[model samples]
Target: DVKVTQSSRYLVKRTGEKVFLECVQDMDHENMFWYRQDPGLGLRLIYFSYDVKMKEKGDIPEGYSVSREKKERFSLILESASTNQTSMYLCASSSPTLLSNQPQHFGDGTRLSIL
Candidate 1:
């Protein structure tokens, strides 16, 4: 079974502090994504990587960045945590095949709070 593991299930950080959220996939997927889920805004994309060391900005990449030094690992960096950034962060991975409907596997997500 494909598994995506997040470094933490819950985290708290002070405003203006830098935060790092880590994710690891065991399925050797080539595509990985980071998203933040909010109450009314829904899930908004943060960043995504197609391969090692390759990343692209997603819908909301202003206060965030991503690192993918290895195929199995992806890290999301919050440059400076803010009160508005508090939300549920999700990490997903998928294997791209010939079909465009590839399903992505997601971690349980990390609920982050910025105080």
Candidate 2:
């Protein structure tokens, strides 16, 4: 079974603080994604990497960044956390070679609280 591990299940921070959320997948997936979930906004992709060292910014990329130095690891970074940025962040992994209709397997998610 494929498993995705998130470094923190819950986090709290003050405004203007830098936050780092880490994710690691046991499966050797070719694609990894970071998304922020909020009320009414649904799940908005923040960034994704198709391969090692390759990254693509998603819809809401203004307040977030991502890193993919290895095939099984992806990290999301918030340069300066803000109150509005407080939300549940999800990490997912899927194989690019798989069928396009296939759904991505998501991690448990990290709930970030920005005061």
Q: Which portions of model 1 miss their true places by more than 4 Å?
A: 97-99
* Minimal lDDT window, size 10, model 2: 95-104
Predicted candidate 1 versus true structure: per-residue lDDT over 13-72, tens digit per residue: 999999999999999899999999999988999999999999999999999999999999
- Model 1, residue 103: C-alpha shift (Å): 0.8
| Regions more than 4 Å wrong, model 2 | none
Per model, state how many residue pairs clash: 0, 0
TM-score attained by model 2: 0.94
lDDT of 2 by residue, 18-109 (tens): 99999999989998999999999899999998899999989999988888899999999999999999999999999766447657989999
What is the Cα-based lDDT of residue 7 in candidate 2?
97
Report model 1's TM-score to 2 decimal places. Answer: 0.96
Worst-scoring 10-residue span by lDDT in model 1: 96-105
- Go through the candidates in order and give each one's C-alpha lDDT: 0.95, 0.92
How does residue 35 of candidate 2 score in lDDT? Answer: 94
